[model samples]
Target chain A: MSSTPVFITGLGAVSAAGTGCAATLESFRNGNGNPCTAAREETPIAKPVFTVGDPAAIANAEEMRTLRLATLAVDEALSDARFRKRPSDIRVGVCLGTTVACQLNDIDFYRELRASGQASAVVFDRYLRGNLSAAVAERYGFCGPTLTITNACSSGTDAIGMALAWLRAGLCEAAIAGGADELSRIPMAGFNALGIMSATACAPFDRDRQGLNLGEGAGILLLETDAGVARRDAPAVLTCEGYGTFGDAHHLTAPREDGSGLEAAIRGALTTAGCAPDDIGFINAHGTATATNDAIEGTVLARVFGTDCVLSATKGYTGHTLGAAGGLEAVFTALGLREGWIPASAGYKNRDTSIPVAPVTRMTNVTGRYALSTSLAFGGNNSALVLGRQP
Target chain B: MKTVLGVHGIGMISVCGRGIESHADAYNHTQSADSSSPIRVCRVADEILKDRVTLKKMRRADRFSKMSALAARDAIDLAGLRVSDGGIRLGIVVATAFGPHRATFEFLDEILDFGDAGVSPTLFSHSVHNAAAAYIAIMLGSRGPACTVTDFQYPFHAGLMTAAVWLHEQRCSHVLVGYTEESSTPMDRILAQRHRGQPSHEPVLFNFSPYASKMFSEGSVFLVVTRPDQGGVALDLDRFKTGNDRISGLGSLWAAFKDGGLHLPQH
Candidate 1:
């Protein structure tokens, strides 16, 4: 049996709010939003993306343009973990989830290479494949196992889950786990082609909900084994009680009509955490605001936790970060638990009749020990995580 | 004390060949790339793998994942378990430095060209990292834990560690491990962009069998590892008692023992 309790020693996030965990947490508490009109595209929806920084802003930016959004998020998370520069003796493992990394860069680099026949294309090698984790490892001076998970939207949650396992198995004293994605024109075009991109703002679980806006960001959390935590001075924000992952294989993109796969994932998480429905105070829902995701997730929540659980989707704040959704949502859930305040679900007004669950439309307060964060992704990948106050 | 692990069955495929004989032949040939070329690649020609597997869906899977699944399947069959009846508590795990780069880039092309309209759902679905594991599970009808791991460098070894933990926890009876690295159009583009003046390298996949500790090779490595039984085949891991095998390069000890082969590659 696992005897020791793992703790959150540090956090790093690169979201619309800013680059630091403290900034993100502050935005969450103050309800600061990072929405802006899209700068490059003429399409109304494409405008107002949560861009990190202008490509022209950074030094030698084009050389590393292929770098994934997960890289940014991971850098912050490692910084958040508070590893001193060139520190030795810290066994750090990294696990990240994302649907794609530097996919946008790949597209540009390939296009340019094909067009010019000159190698003057975008820097695709910098963020190719596992280099995202390698970059983080090199940045933080960690020399342990590195794992990257890509399970649609649930990838981020799975990353965190694996981090917990890394700690539980005593593989590493500390781990930096999260998910990230830099917006790719390919996914945006695909979603748009699928006719899911909302023309305006995404209104998850709302009757007037149109569709979702593809956004880019990264969310990362630092996890430490019990021994590592005991050596640290800061208190843990929240304890990760359990995480469960499942795949439907039912359909590629669409979820099960009955939400059976999602149901199984939620039950698995709850069972693993030994928590009951009544114990949960808030739900950081996947809530893509698409007709399919919202309806299915809404039905599953209503059936499992009833309509009373405070539900919210942060996509309004950070357009669906895809692979990073779960990690970002997990971070949001942890922040909510630590701050003792439930955040308001942006772009939600009237709850859709199809979804009987009552989504928290405004900021509310609740004092509960447990909370649940759920994610449903393309290819029917589903996952749920349970977080609670430490005893 | 933690239980020691062993490897029982092993399979691998690459530009070299499939199975153990192919491994020995390829290495003896000194199949290194020519340093004088602008781009050097050790690629498994499309016709070769297609001829061997005789599976049509092989086209849909990225080369890396195809090699991965092939290596895993070879290992599973070598283990001699009846998957139809579900005898072994089998799980499928694979590590790849890049997850389906070619297909990903293809999806990008389709989405960009067609404006994301009428993009093949099949292409979009196959672009995911776990698609290989999902395909392997469906092909093998495996109900046990199925996961896809990526970490850019030596992802297969990292996956090996993960499988080890699963065994330690008694989560599964036997775990099948495979790793493959394939070239992508974008990967080439990225390489050219990164080291514009430096010599280029081609995509390569390295496979490993449990009996082999042959490092520095690129291909898929498949090994069936089992819990130690009194009569079961075992590879003694006395040198790696502490679990901190990072420096000792003891990641494949469990694979070696579980492979059940008499010979092990000596460094």
Candidate 2:
């Protein structure tokens, strides 16, 4: 890859926290999370879920909910980047990560087919057209490469990382990258079956954390190469310095107990950025509040960055948005660096004694040039991104 | 400048058979369309998927994972590389249009039969799209970067692009990049409904029209790609970016490789 810096020209986010970057920052400033019971009629489980406040208002009836969420974030990102639409002259790739959107797990369609050997083609058609990155590229007239990453939970981070590679390789002058997923009964039932769904709100990294609460939303970034940013005269406050990903090669559902894969990914990101561990201001951890995830991730964080690395888990505010977690946390990390403060790790009242690291308990000011965001996903995929702020 | 990657080894499994030799043989002697069946569906035989030795550990794995693992393992073996060998940072990238739909439906069946809380966790875990990549990683003991991408259009091309980027960035010593798809009952039903009255015949290669009749197939293809200096069939990554409709899916890419139609640049 080229040595040129990939600049984050715009940011867009939507979750239980709020819609758009401004609203999300406001929610972080207040340190209050909105966790409610699954309100969709199709969901049988009564576990708490973090859903976007209004989806119908943003999307038409013909579009799938996941595509709707993605479109909303992409539009906000484009607007923030001062473009009404993708530039006509430049090549811009669209790489979005998604889980729920990639599968054809429509229960009603399956039920109908199983019963009568026939079903409506609407669901099938929607699925065929709902490849997240392709849909975004079509919507925005992006003419560069397009890919929809489906590496389980770390998909968004991988998508962003892939886009970074594309930019550095000169495949595209700019790219729209991140992740999006909508609340669905399929995952709700699946997660509940796995016994990882928390009955109440999630408390990531807390001592008495039970498990994770599902959430729905999208997080998107408009990343541009140095030349692209300069050509458009766009404000460049933060640069995506580096990205690294590695697999545990151990289990499908569980992370490696040793955290070797995650450590390698983090160290790889640091090495790519040419920075030491001490230069990082804070880390946005993928703390899903599940017993195994927290224990393993906490151990790795303490081992790599030491116990006082100024890290926090934001899943407390957004729930475990699955594919969107990485993207949302990346945006949150960049926001923290640019805005000069980090929010308290919400829902974290007591730290577990077994884990050496305690997350920031209060809204804290930070002065640093760079921050890190990490995601450990199912299928034992671990990914990390290093974002640097311009002094 | 375009990045040229060396195709160190290739592995594939399809209706034609298993391994690159089988593919080359099938390409040399093309079989006439089977007119007996109303729908011309190219299905991988059950025998083609049976590998008791390599798949002993993956007994519980779905067909998607099994197919992916078999092809990936074959590629690694053909490349004369062992996962046990130290200092080999092997990365994996698997692309698919529809990933593990059969497993997903099975998980849904569990959900419908038993309530949400009573469903089986194993089925739920396997239903994920990345399960195949995970299975490959575990089978090979590769601890490098692994990624899975899904796209109806240009999935194989996208996987190759990502693989090239990983190689250029020196993320891994060698990358196992491939595509896998499984034909499920619902997919067949959809295809049947879409082409209810159309005549059934073998797919016409290089037909890029919008309204062409479609015949669906299922299988996996993998290639071990390394830097150009490795001295193998050189693949120009720029050719993929031009949106060559003739070389769109895995089937076409496999055919191109088997027929030596790729026009690989000489190093």
Off by over 4 Å in 1: A1-3, A17-34, A39-48, A53-86, A102-105, A116-125, A128-130, B1-5, B16-24, B27-66, B80-91, B108-121, B141-145, B169-173, B184-221, B226-267
lDDT of 2 by residue, A1-391 (tens): 4678899999989888888889988988998777887645456689888888875555665778888888888888888889658578789999999999989888888888778878678888888789999999998889998989998899999999989988888889999999999888888888887898788888888899999998888999999998988899887999999998988999999899999999999999998887888899999999999999999999998898899889878888888889888888898998999899988888898879998887888899988898999999989999999999998
Least lDDT summed over 10 consecutive residues: which range in candidate 1 chain B?
B241-250
- The digit string of per-residue lDDT tens for model 1 on A337-365 reads 87777667778888577687857777788
User: Candidate 1's residue-wise lDDT over B50-134, tens digit each?
Assistant: 7445345456656656777777787787777666675566766776666666677777677556654557656766676777776
Which candidate's TM-score is highest? 2
What is the docking quality class of candidate 2? medium
Number of the top DockQ candidate: 2
Error of 1 at B26 (Å): 3.4
Question: Model 1 chain A — which ten-residue stretch has the worst lDDT?
Answer: A57-66
Against the true structure, what is model 2's DockQ? 0.70
